[model samples]
Every structure is written in structure tokens, then in C-alpha cells.
Target: MLTIGKLGQAAGVKVPTIRYYEQIGLLPEAERSAGNQRLYSRKALDRLTFVRHARELGFTLDAIRDLLSLSDHPDQPCAAADAIAKAQLAEIEKRLARLASLKVELKRMVAQCAGGSIADCRVIEVLGNHSLCAAEHGPRESEGDS
Candidate 1:
């Protein structure tokens, strides 16, 4: 049995995250002691560990719920789980591509700056006018209010 803080420390998760998982039904409500302190069994620890591992791998809460549901039914086909993994991989690839592009553009921008004053700074000059920028900037740069 442990207090919430002790449980969080043991599980390598924050206390609020544990509460969030509980609120979202990923974790079952723990049995309370005489002073209303939450207690856990080894089973709860295992479940929380599973949930924490999934989250550390970047699975969204909704996807974690789906994975948990799939895990509960051992006889189910694993095609759905495969699809989720594929989606996450695709997202990671997309982010990597975007980051690579950003790196290239930043290098190009930095090359233009020669430690001049702000009025003559090529970096600021190119940024203030996208038409003057050599790099084909993406959609994330414009329409800030949206």
C-alpha cells in the first residue's frame, strides 16, 4: 500500500498524470484505507506500468485506450494494433522531414547574416519578406491568428 505520491514515484509517473489516467478510466479507482488513502495491489502496479510505458512511447490517451481494449481481448486480430503503430511511424517520419527542412532553412538564413546591425541584418531582412527568402517556406509560417 502507498500514498499517491509514493505510488507515483514507484510507477515513474507524476501524481497528476495518475489522477488523469484514473479520471479517464485507464486506471481503476484504488481501494481506500481508513484515512481515505489510495492503496494498490501488484496488479494495479502492472497496469499502471503498462500505461506509463505506452505513454512514454508517445501514444495518445485515445490510442492508449484502444490498445488497452485490444489487450484485454487476447483473441482479437492484431491488424488494428499494427495500423496504430504505422500511423505513429508515419507521424514521426513527417515530423522528421519538417525538422530537416527547418534545419536547412535556418542554415541558409544564418549564412546570410554577417553580424551586421539590425537595419542591415540579412537574417531579419529575409524573414520580414518571405518573397525574398530562397527557401520555399511551409504553411506553418503564415496565418498566425488561425
Candidate 2:
């Protein structure tokens, strides 16, 4: 058995993050040593690794929880997992489209600037008056859904 610190080190996750995962039920509660220190088995390390990878891939805690549940039953169909991945892909695509629009607007604003004073700056003007924008590049209704 490994101590909590060792488990965190092997999993490349912070100690507090591991604790948070446990608190949120993403990780199983760790066993304790005779002295009351947290002890973890190799299985815990593997689960932590999986959680870290899923987090790096931008999966939310709830999605990671769902994925973990699905993984626990390997014999089950993968359609739910596939659907989750597809939803993430759609979200990424929407963000990409928004970013592209922002790029175009920024380019337009910069190209229109003649390097005059701030009062004559096209970028400043457009920013001050959203009506001057040719396209809607503002935040979406679900901007902070993640």
C-alpha cells in the first residue's frame, strides 16, 4: 500500500485534488494506516490517473463521473460513452466557430485602424459601440456553462 503522498506523486495529481475527488465521490474513500494517515492501493493510483486524463481532456466532473461508472462495467455497451464524447466535440466546435468569428472581427478592427489617437481608433470605437460590429461576436447565452 502507498501513502496518500505517494499515490498523488504516482498519479501526477496534487494531494488536495485527490482529496477533492474523494470528497466528490469521483475517487473511492482511501483506507487509513494504523497511525490514521491515508493509505492507497495500486487500484487507487490507476483510478486517479484515469480521472486526471479525463480532466485534461476537458471533461467536467459530472461527465467524468458518468464515464467512470461506465468503465466500471466493461461488458456494458459504449453508446453512452460515445454520446458523451460527441457532446464534448460539439461544444468544442461551437467554441472554435466563436473564436474564428472573434479573429475576423479583430482583424477587421486592426485593419481599419490608421494608428491615430484613441479618439480616432477604429478598435476603440468598435469596442465602445457594439452596434458598429458587423457580426455578433459577443459571449453566448451559455458562455460559462462549463
Candidate 3:
């Protein structure tokens, strides 16, 4: 049996995260010792490790839950898991494209800067007037926020 801290260390997860997973039903509740402290079995350690690995791969908590549910039923097909991985890949590709555009815009802004005072700063001017920006940065999430 492993204490919560030991289980966290073994699984490469933090203690609070393990506790949260238990609360959220990702991990089963650990048995308690005579002193009322949590004690984890090897199964808990393995489950925590799986959860940590999924998180490191950028799976959202909801998707992780789905994957876990699928994993519990050994006879089930893996189409759902495949779909989740494909969706993650598509999201990554979209982010990469956005980041590339952002890089181009930043480079243009930096290249146009003449090291002048703020009154004549190209960077400041471009930032103040979005129309002056060379690339189209799509509407930000907080666009409607004052």
C-alpha cells in the first residue's frame, strides 16, 4: 500500500490532482489506513499513471473520462478513441496555422520599428490602429468586452 504522497510520486501526479481525480470519479476512492489516511493499491498507481500520460498528451478532462470509460470495457471497439485522437490532431494543426500567422505579423511589426521615440514608434502606431497591421489577426475572444 502507498500513501497519497507516495502514490503521487510514483504516478508523476501531484497529491491534490490525485485527490481531485478521486472527487471527479476519474480514480476510485482510495482505502483508508487505521489512522484514517489514504492508502493506494498498485491498481491506483497504474490508473493515476494512465491519467497523467493522457493529460501530458493534451487530452481534456472530459475526453480523458471518455477514454477511461472506453478502456474499462475491453470488448469495445476503439473507434471512439481514434476519433478523439484525430480531433486533437486537427486542433493542433489549427493552432499551428494561427501561430505561424502571428509570427509573420510580429516579424513585420519588429522590422518596421525604427527605434524612434514612442511618439513616432511604428509598433505603437500599428498596435493602436489595427488596420495598419499587415496580417489579419482574427477577432479576439474578448473583443466585445470593454
- In candidate 2, what are the lDDT values of residues 1-146, reduced to their tens digit? 99988888999999999989999888988899889988999888888899899888888899999999999999999999999999988878887888788788899999999998998999999999988887885655566534
- The lDDT, on a scale of 0 to 1, for candidate 1 is 0.79
lDDT of 1 by residue, 91-139 (tens): 6676667777768878888988889899998788877887876555567
From the highest lDDT down, the ranking of the candidates is 2, 3, 1
Worst 10-residue lDDT window for candidate 3 reads: 137-146
Query: Compared with the true structure, what per-residue lDDT tens digits does model 3 show for residues 1-146?
Result: 99999999999999999999999988877899999999999987887888899898778888889888888897989999999989988866766777788788888888988998999888888889988877776767323311
- TM-score for each candidate, following the candidate numbering: 0.83, 0.86, 0.86
1 versus 2: better TM-score goes to: 2
Model 3 ranges off by over 4 Å: 139-146
Please give the RMSD to the true structure for each candidate, in Å.
3.3, 2.2, 3.3
lDDT of 2 at 18: 90
Tell me the TM-score of model 1.
0.83
The parts of candidate 1 lying over 4 Å away from their true place are: 137-146
TM-score of 3: 0.86
